[model samples]
Every structure is written in C-alpha cells, then in structure tokens.
Target: MFDSIKLRKQHGYQAIRDIRTATVKAPFRGFPRLDGEKCDLSCLACTAVCPTGAIATEPLRIDLGRCTFCGECERGCGTGAIQFSSAHSLASTDRNDLIIQSGQTPESFRETAIQSRREIHRLFGRSLKLRQVSAAGCNGCEMELNAANNVNFDMGRFGIEFVASPRHADGIVITGPISRNMAPALKDAYLSISEPRIVVAVGTCAISGGIFADSAQLDRSFLDEVPVDLYIPGCPPHPLTIIGGLLDFRRHK
Candidate 1:
C-alpha cells in the first residue's frame, strides 16, 4: 500500500483537466496547411509522391479525409509549400470541410469545421455510450480510441464510454476503410443500435478510406447508405482529438 501510494503521488492527475485547451506534441501531425503560391509552375512534386491522391494543384488543396498524416507531402515539397501543424482539433460534420486549401490555417479552419446541433445534445447530453467497429482497420485508430479511456485522457469522466455490445450502445464509432468483407457486418451493427443513435467516422480510413480508398478489397459505400454524425480525420487520430470531438458533439447546444 505504501509503494502504491508513492507511485500515485509520483503521477498526480494523469488525465487532462481540459482537453479543449490542451496542446499536442509539436511532432504530432494533425492538420495540413497549403501554400499554392509558393509552388513553381513546373513543380508537381507533392502530388506525385502523395499516396492517397489527397493533393490537387490549380488552387492547391489537401484532403484531410484521405491523408495518412505520414508527412510525406512535406518531405516531397522542396519549397515548403505544404506543412503539417500540431493542431489536433480535427473533426467535422460535413465531408467537404475536411479539404484544406491554400492560405487556410488549422486554427482558422476549426472555427467552421464543427457546428452545434440541438438533437445531438438533447439525446446524448450527460452520457454517451459507443460501440466501436473496426471494419478492416489496421488497428492504428483502434489503439488511439483505447487510449482515450486511459488515465491520461480519461474520457469517461465526461460521461463517454465504449460498451461491449452494440445493443447497449447509444451510437457506433466506425474505424478503418470498411473492407468488402466487413461491410455487411458493419451495416448489421448500425441496424442493431436503437433509434436516435449517432455514427462517428474516425480516422482517415473511415472518413475517406485513406490510402486504401482505391483498393479492390475495400467497400466504402456504407457511409453513403447511412448518415454520419461526426467525421474525425487523422491517420490515426490522437486521443485528445477523439475525446475533444466527442465532447463537442455532445456539448455546444
């Protein structure tokens, strides 16, 4: 007991008191900032090296939904036109908002990415129980989702939790790119949840299939079939991003 007490004192308040104001590590990649004017007319380097076809010239846009956050675009750009910032508050209700264009900053873009919904708050104001489905996920998003419940993040304190069964869940959180083999099961899980349920697409894969968008084995048609309440964009979204997104979803009404 004495040893346990000593350890407890060593790590006081492991969880973040306020996720909204907390800052992620400088090395972590959350959002991409584009600078189209910096590019030379002959250069198409960023687009050529992009694995997910997320980059497009003319106006210069980087789709956060398809980005793996690998920072490869930054490496490929010699003019420093594309850079990734450490801002982790990357969640959106609309898919189109995930596209980052030239002259946009993460801080500025975030202002319009999320919106207040009365129905969402009225349903899940106090407590929200979610069932996570990894439809052919690489386990990257799954790991981060698990970390949201750890001591450091402690998402449960805000009345959010991941339940074992879909029947007991208030909503479903979908990860991965949704493979052909897993599509049916994914639909079944959504059907299993009770009405007034919400759906959150987490990570780049779930949002826009990431690098696997064009894979023959993947099937992302499920998103089109059902309405998604939230889209959390990241290669593997940070725990803070996941937690903050969820809280904002339930709050701000």
Candidate 2:
C-alpha cells in the first residue's frame, strides 16, 4: 500500500513537470489579437474545441504542428482569435519546430492549404503533363487522384498537370490492379512518355494487386509495364501523400 502511494505521487509530480515544460516552451508569444471591445462576440468557443490543446487564454496562441490544420479551432472561435496564414513552411528538421501563430480563424486554414497548393502548382509549372492509368483499382484511389486537382486538395500546385495523351506527359501515375484487360493500355502509356520520365505506382492495388492478389485476371505486378520510381502503398493514399510523392520526385530530379 505504501509503495502504491509513492508511485502515485511520483506520477503526479511528472505530470506537473510536463505541464510546466509545455508552458515554458509554448511557441506563440505576442500573437496579434482582435480588439474585443470593437467586436461584440461573447463566446470563447475556440478554447473549448481545439483538438491539440494548442490554444491558451490570458493571450490566445496556437502551436501549428500540434494543429492538424483541421480548422476546428477557427470554426469554434466566435471572437475570431484564431486565423490562418499561407505559411506552409510548417516543416522542420526538429519535430517541435512546426509550431506557428496566425491569430486568424478556421476559414484561414482552408485558405492556407489552398494557397499552399497554388504555390506548389506555380513552382511545378502549368502544363498538362502527366498520364495516369489504373489497372485493376476499386476506384477509391482514382477518386483521390481526381480530388487532388479539385478545389479542395488542389493538386495542381506541384504542377501535377494531367494529360490525356501519354505523348504529352513527363511521367505516368498508375493505380489499380494490373488487370489483363488494362495491361496493353498501361504498357502503351509507359512507352509513350519521353525519355528521362518517371512512373509512380499508387495504392497497393497497383503495387501488388492488393485484394486481387490471387486473381488470375490481375497481373499482380507493377514493374511488368515499366520501371516504377515511387511506390505509394495505401488502400487509397491521401491526396497530400500523393502530392508529397510528386514533390519528392522533383527534389530527386
């Protein structure tokens, strides 16, 4: 009984230390604030809904990394203490370095992600330039790939301009199973791209035919058509992951 009490006290002390550490290392200091008098909002909803516990009272702040960029806090804030900025340098060598302060609202986070995609597109250049073919996919991967170019995920930022003709493309983005029916089309697409090209096999279906592993109709081989530069193995990888893979390709080139 005495040992149990001692262990409990030790855990309590550690918890207090953690809180203290977080307080001292808090990233947002002197972030801008609205004139509460000028704005007649009565509720502090941001404080209640922040998923990461990144927001604070006394003066409002946000740790960007802890934030999922989900915009929940901004939506919850009635006084508009939280906001988004187009600052996408949320990456860091140190994991803790991604914290940021915008003082904007949740609406801003959406704008920021959009703006970031735009910047990525601009940097990558605006040319309809890649051919994508799915061999034996469930369509989920294709939907996400399409969404990257849609208004929300906005894949055009990395200059992921899709092309209808393989001859006009710089690379091939493949998804789905390498079904026998699609094999000829996939091979043709790979062959049609110019030299110094790339192939990205997206989703587990394209990589290994996923659930269709034993199906005789599925080739179960991405390499049969062309040499793959990147393999994104997910049931259907997120749009951001697709973008990241493209960006990584750019870095290598």
Per-model RMSD to reference: 1.4, 21.9
Q: Write the per-residue lDDT of candidate 1 for residues 1-253, one digit (tens) a residue.
A: 9999999899887878877899988788887878888976478888889999988888788888888888887998899888898989889888898888899987788788888698778878888999999999999999999999999899999899999999999999999999999999999999999998999999998988887887999988888889898999887999988998888777774
Which of the numbered candidates is closest to the native, going by highest TM-score?
A: 1
- What does the lDDT read for residue 177 in candidate 1? 92
1-31 per-residue lDDT for model 2 (tens digits): 9999998877653222221112212222222
Off by over 4 Å in 1: none
Total clashing pairs for each candidate: 0, 14
Model 2: lDDT of residue 233:
42
Candidate of highest lDDT: 1
For model 2, state the Cα shift of residue 86 in Å: 23
Alpha carbon RMSD to native, model 2: 21.9
Question: What's the true lDDT of residue 188 in model 2?
Answer: 78
Residue 228 in candidate 1 has what lDDT?
A: 92
